[model samples]
Structure formats: structure tokens, C-alpha cells
Target: MTGWRRRETKREEQIIRVLQEPPEAIDLRGARRWRWADEHWRVWLRRSATGVELFTRWQESDEYRYMLGDDAYQMQLIEILTRATPRDCAAAGFGCTRRMDRACSEPSICSRDPLPAAGVDPHREGPVPGGCDSFYGGDDVRVRFSAGNRHQAVRWSMSLWIDGVRVGAGLRLASSGWWLDDRFFVVPAEGPDEHPAQEYTMGDLVSVIHSVLIHDAALSVTRVLVPGPEEMWTEPWVVRDGDELRVYPDQETSRGPDRTIVLTD
Candidate 1:
């Protein structure tokens, strides 16, 4: 059973009232309410009539929307663009597509020999001196990188950027992914226009990196936070540059010499 619930403050009552039966314009101008959003209903409020109206949307489905009444608490047509844009999932392969803000950075990363036999769990703790290996660490962390066109994983304070674009929290791999939710990033300027940032799936991220490497030759991933294995923390990544990006799993970041970048989870 849940514990006793806290009583709603007057402000909370005001906000709830705004959602059900919206007030008039004068009320809207005077009333101030916080926006509501969660995993279920991405709820929001905006001015309407005299008070406000409430609107909610499903994250998994774009076609679904809920409205309360003539009085509204949702944003106007212009601000709706953010909620209207669809999640880009064209490149999801062998893994689930995710919003950059929702990805979990599990400390323990499952690593396996680059070429393991058919049915082995990749989570084997210690590697054979020179074989593949998994890793471990704490959760809730953000790693920074100095990257360029020959791209690498990216992050920011509240947005995750890959190849100069915003991406969701999920950068899912075979086992898990980076917890880049709320991280921040910036899109490099191209020609005369500044790039607009948005989220990208893992596949999309890989594809964009490839494109940047081959086509955007002029750009180098600046201040990139390389996506290390789940077990990475201030570790040196054994990057294998080839047709495909390969970040070999290693504990160098934790045990490496002082010269290596030392970051805490």
C-alpha cells in the first residue's frame, strides 16, 4: 500500500482546475501553471478562454491525442511542432530505437571476444589477457568526448548530440546502451544555415557518423564523449578504425596511467 499522499497546494488545485474547466483569457494572463509530462501522457498546459486547457499525447503513437474542452492548457499551433515531429527510426537494426533522454548507462557492460562461439553469454567478467571483455561501473553519469567528422558517440548537459544533431537517450547496442538522457549537444553549422538538432536512433547515429566521416570530411568530432562499453570510466578506448566503427572493450580508463583522461561515473 502507498503511504499517505501529500495534500495538493493551492497552486496545484489551480493547475488541476485549469485542466478540467478552463478559465477565461483574463484568468490565463494571471494564472501560472507548470507543464505536466510523464512516460504515459506527455501532458501540457496552455492559455485558453479565461483560464487554461489540458492536452496530452501518447509517446508510442503519434495519431493519438486527448483534449478536454474549449478552454485549453496546451501550446498553440506554433509550439506544437516539437510534439508533432515523428521519431526517426529508419536505421534501427538488431536493436531497439530509443529517445536519447531515456537511455540507461548501466555500469556493467557485457563484452565478448570479437568473434565468440555461437551461444556464450558476453558477460564473462575477466578477459583472457588479450581477448574480448565486459566491464562494470556506477549508473547515472555523462561522458564527454572531443570528436570530429570521423565521428564518435556524443553527449551534453540535457541533450544527446550525434554528428551535430540531437538524439534520444537510447543508443542501444547488443546488450545495453548509454544513459545520455538530459545530456546536451550542438549541431555544426553547414553552409549558410545552422543545423537543427533532433533525436536519432542507434542505427541513425551509426549512419550519421558514417556519413560525416565519408562526406563531411571537413568536420571533426570536436569535444566528443566517446561511447565506451558499459564498463567504461576514464578508460582509454582501443578504437579500431575500419569500414565499421569498433570500440574495443578495455578497462584502461580506470587503471590506465595518469596521462589518460580520468572521469567518474
Candidate 2:
């Protein structure tokens, strides 16, 4: 028999509450869109029924969003964006796609190499030495970029940005960031594992989420979704389909039920 049950900390208790029921989503239709940009990122803001919606365009590439609620949050976010500046390294990643592909072939070397200018090759002088860039978010959102570790296998750390401010407590595994709507972004992450670490059959891993992280920009809070006691889902993927979010394993052979959550209030 297990000795004594460990008491959940305030953070753990909050995670439990959020897993039981997610925070409310505010409607964003008919909202006004505002724009802000610096050298590296472009930001778009739209004020909704009860909060604001923020979208980021990364260095002429991908776009993602964050939804923030409450009236005061908007003013604060704007002030931060207005004062934001670009990092010297921010431009290093702008056109590194081809370089990234080449670097990944030997990631340790790529991650630790120095960044070359847009049209230059970083691999010319053996493996470029030492780190790379930084990223910043706009209007109720925050962004971070890591200059991969040379000594260890590369994995990303979870970082959260709120009201254009960076908060250090979010977790993300294997770099999963899926937007649930104009406001929420979901991240599949590492959770509490009571079982001993050992190899488990794929069959034993489906239907469980150590935890699922959902950022409610409207509430400026990061919410977590955990599984019930008996089932643990492995390598889950969250996808948005019209008014609903579905969480399921990415593999085809896994025998697990897909968890669905409705986005409409």
C-alpha cells in the first residue's frame, strides 16, 4: 500500500481546477484591429467583447495568436509594444530555413555555431561556434528563442508571455504550439509521473496527457489539462476544427479515445 498521499501545492491545485473546466472564451467578432511592428516582428491587436485578440507575424514568416481579456490589459499591452526594440540576434533567424535544414543534419554543430548574415553560410568555418537569436512578442503576447545547447540533446523549454510581458512558468514539449482560435494556444507538455521511469509498450502509453497547457490570454492565465487516474495519453496532438478542439495521439495504431472540448460558450 502507498504510505501517505502527498498534498497538492497551490499550483497543483490550480492545475487540477483548470483540467476539470477550462476558462471561458470571449467572442472576438467585430473587434477592431490595431497594428504594431519593429525590425523583427509585426503585431496585430483586436479588442473583443470582453478582452483583446493579439496576432504575431514573425519576420515575414509564420503567424500565431494570443487572446487577452479584461479592459486594462489592452492599454498595458500597447505601452509595452510601443517601447519594444529588436535584438541584434533577431535578424539571424529570418531566413535560416535552408540553414536550419542543413544544421539539423548535425544539430549539435548547428545549434552551437555562430549565425551568419541572411545570404551567408554558417557552416563555412567548420561548425559555427556559440549561440544564436532572440524573439519578442507584441500586444498581450510574448515570444522567446533559444540558442540550442551543445552538450545535451536539444529540447525546448516552455516560456509564457502575457500582456506583452514574459512570465517564466509555461511548459512545452517537442515544440508543440497549436492555436485553438483567435485567442487560445495549446501546448502538450510533461506532467506528474508517479510510475517509475522504464520502457513501456506503445499500447500502454495512449489515452494519457501528462498535461495539456492552454493559455487564456483573455484571463492572462495558463491552464492545464490532465488525464483521469487510469489512462495516460502519450504524444498527444491538439487540433482545432471549427468550434471544437480535439486531443489525440498522432500515431495511427494507438487505441485511445480522442478528447474533445467545445469552444463555443
TM-score leader? 2
TM-score of each: 0.19, 0.37
lDDT of 1: 0.24
Per-residue lDDT of candidate 1, residues 168-199 (tens digit):
43332111222111121223111111112222
Instruction: Superpose all Cα atoms of candidate 2 onto the true structure and report the RMSD in Å to 1 decimal.
Output: 20.2
Q: Write the per-residue lDDT of candidate 2 for residues 156-200, one digit (tens) a residue.
A: 233444344443364434343444443555656565465333223
Task: Report the backbone clash tally of model 2.
Answer: 12
Q: For model 1, what is the error of residue 77's alpha carbon versus the real structure, in angstroms, after optimal superposition?
A: 14
Please state the error at residue 213 of candidate 1 in Å.
13
